[model samples]
Target: RDLNALGGLAKLMPFTAIFTLIAALSIAGTPPFNGFMSKWMIYQSTFLSGNGLLVFFGVMALFISAATLASFIKFYTTAFGGEPTKLTQNVKEVSSSMLIAKGFLASLCLLLGLIPALILPLLLSPGKALANVDLSGLITT
Candidate 1:
């Protein structure tokens, strides 16, 4: 999809930054964001599985986080770096509406990261529907 949007992966550095920012916001489990729900599922599942191997998943999450930061740095160092090339010099700041949209999504991402519990009921709906199970009793020890 990014390729389709930017003509190819060669022109994808900017998209990569936005993508990394989104991932970072998500891992934090803030509020009003999908990332919160996703991390919540990871936390809930890891605890419920009651297996030591599940603990390793937490480490994996951290590794993913480091990788996200690295990717974003790559995007910044290249896409917005010093000495803009001919092609990049023509680029201008995105429109206000586009920036506002991005900011709104970014804000939601932060919200989800901050208060995941606020969305627990909505997040758990899928688990409820799947097996007709009541997960209210499951607690991480």
Candidate 2:
């Protein structure tokens, strides 16, 4: 979905802000976003697995973050920002309605990011039914 919005694969470029956001969130162990908490569990599970090579996996996760940032910078500078050209001159700012929609979604993203507690309970209902574990009590929020 984000790929489609950013542009197709042919012209597609990475966005570091998005990747950094994912990495930071993943490392934080917060809930409701399905990022931080899951990665924390995975890190714990890997350590418990008793596989010494799991260290490499953890290292790779960090390395991938650097790569993600580099890719995002390349894409942002090359694809999005530049002096206007003929093809791009035709492009206009997205409509106010579209901006409003994006702004609402962005706020939702931030809200989920800042307060996972609100989302954790709502998600736990269905998640427990499927996973058969009481995750509701696990989240701080």
Q: Identify the leading candidate in terms of TM-score.
A: 1
**lDDT of model 2 at residue 44?**
52
Query: Would you list the clashing residue pairs of candidate 2?
Result: 16-72, 29-36
Tens-place lDDT per residue, model 2, 1-141, is 232234222222223334334444443443444455445445654555667798778766656655655765555544354454444445545566765665565556566656666566776689788988886654543
Shift in Å, residue 24, candidate 1: 5.7
Candidate 1, which ten residues in sequence have the lowest lDDT sum?
Answer: 1-10
lDDT of each: 0.57, 0.52
- Model 1 score (lDDT): 0.57
Q: Which stretches of candidate 2 lie over 4 Å from their true place?
A: 1-69, 139-141
Best by lDDT: 1
| Candidate 1: stretches off by over 4 Å | 1-37, 40-44, 136-141
Cα lDDT, model 1, residue 64: 71
